[model samples]
Target: LATGDMGIANTTPAACLVAAFTGRPPEEVTGRGTGIDDATFERKVRVVREGLSLHRPDPSDPLGVLAAVGGLEHAALAGVILAGAAERVPVVLDGVNADAAALVAVALAPAARGYVVAGHRSVEPGAGAALSHLGLRPLLDLGMRLGEGTGALLAVPTVRAAAAVLRDMATFEEAGIER
Candidate 1:
């Protein structure tokens, strides 16, 4: 399942959700999103930390965590992941926002984790931490910080290549060549 959208302050919510779910320091999960200045960056971090504290996410209750700290895009992405899992389709997570949504999805339905693919490493600080926590290695890392599915869109060719190799490339036996 592929999805994309735009929203302001998405990174803040993402960082907060990630820190809440992973128990990481908000500073560790936060970054200079969209060229935010030092002061603004600090404020973003503080907001995330405070939001986490205010929400007090219960790891066992995914909905509570989402409602308390999640952005609208994150909630939608979580639904997309859930739908993909129900249909046995893979979801390619884009940036920090999508990764945050995937985290919520996995929390709500542990089995959905099997249906998710980390498309790329986003420049967002929480992106790397979230992917690491989920044991996912993205196919690319171009230092992209955009959150509009740009990274995931760029990864489609590679995904297609992998599928081609798996489905069409000749095996040694079929080629009748020496190993």
Candidate 2:
């Protein structure tokens, strides 16, 4: 519901949660998305703080956490992650929002973390903490914050390359190398 609440706005609950999880006020962690005026930024920060304080969902219970403050998009992304994990497919996480959803997925199924791939690093401070918690080192840092799965889309080539490597690379014995 948080994303719905901030429709067309850059201020997302994932962004706010990032700040909260990192123990920083929004002023410290919030990026100037689209260059809001100072007054608007302050208000945005206040809104984030209020949202977090109001819910205060425990990280251990992802369902409760989602119902407490997350939006439909977050939940949907989490379902996607879970489905990928179930199918044993690699799932690329895009940005802070994806990271937040992945956090929920991990809480739901600890093994899901093994199937996740961080597509890129987000400028959002909360993203780093979530990445660290998930033990995922992002594969890229293009300085892009487009969210909307753009990062994951860009990571496709890397994923295909990894698969090709595993499938086509010859073993030292097969190549007749004397190690």
Candidate 3:
């Protein structure tokens, strides 16, 4: 969800949102998105902190939070999550940014979590906060931070296979086999 930065650090919506919700200096929550140099990273942190000053997010109102600090991708991701819940499909979350977006989605629709899954554990510390807030446990812990849904995609087959087994596999009593 929140992967490579698409625009200038100081100008990006995602940076603003992260800062507002975190209330931490960028150095505390920011990372080299795609391995930027020290100067760029510093600027990224400064920009995030500055953005936070511009917009303060209220966690109780997730959509307001999204509107205040979230980018197009964040909004779109939230939309997908809502759609999944409406259609009764499970959505597998990817990494850090995804976790933040998930928080927004969860705030919007608490029941939406019933159709959600944590795909992996992200290297980002904030990610753990999001998961803990949502009461989700990741199925895998490759210590990854790959966004663009790659991490979630990686877990899809595993999730589907597990679903298949639960739906189709026979129990000992049904199979008439020994316990």
Estimate TM-scores for all models.
0.93, 0.85, 0.79
Query: Model 2 TM-score?
Result: 0.85
lDDT of 2 by residue, 1-179 (tens): 11111234543566665554445666665655556789887887787778878877666667887777677777887888899899998888877777878888888899998889998887766567778878899888888766667777788789889989999999999999989
Count of clashing pairs, candidate 1: 0
- Per model, how many backbone clashes are there? 0, 2, 0
RMSD (CA, Å), candidate 2 to true, equals 3.8
Q: lDDT tens string, model 1, 62-140? A: 8999999988888989999999999998888888988888889999899999989888898888999999988899988
| Most lDDT-accurate candidate | 1
Which stretches in model 3 have alpha-carbon errors above 4 Å? 1-26, 177-179
Model 3 agreement with the true structure over 1-179: per-residue lDDT tens digits = 21221333322354455555555445655666566789987877777666666766776777888887777677777777788888998888876666677767778888988988888877665566567767999887886656656778778889899999999999999999986
Cα shift from native, residue 65, model 3 (Å): 0.8
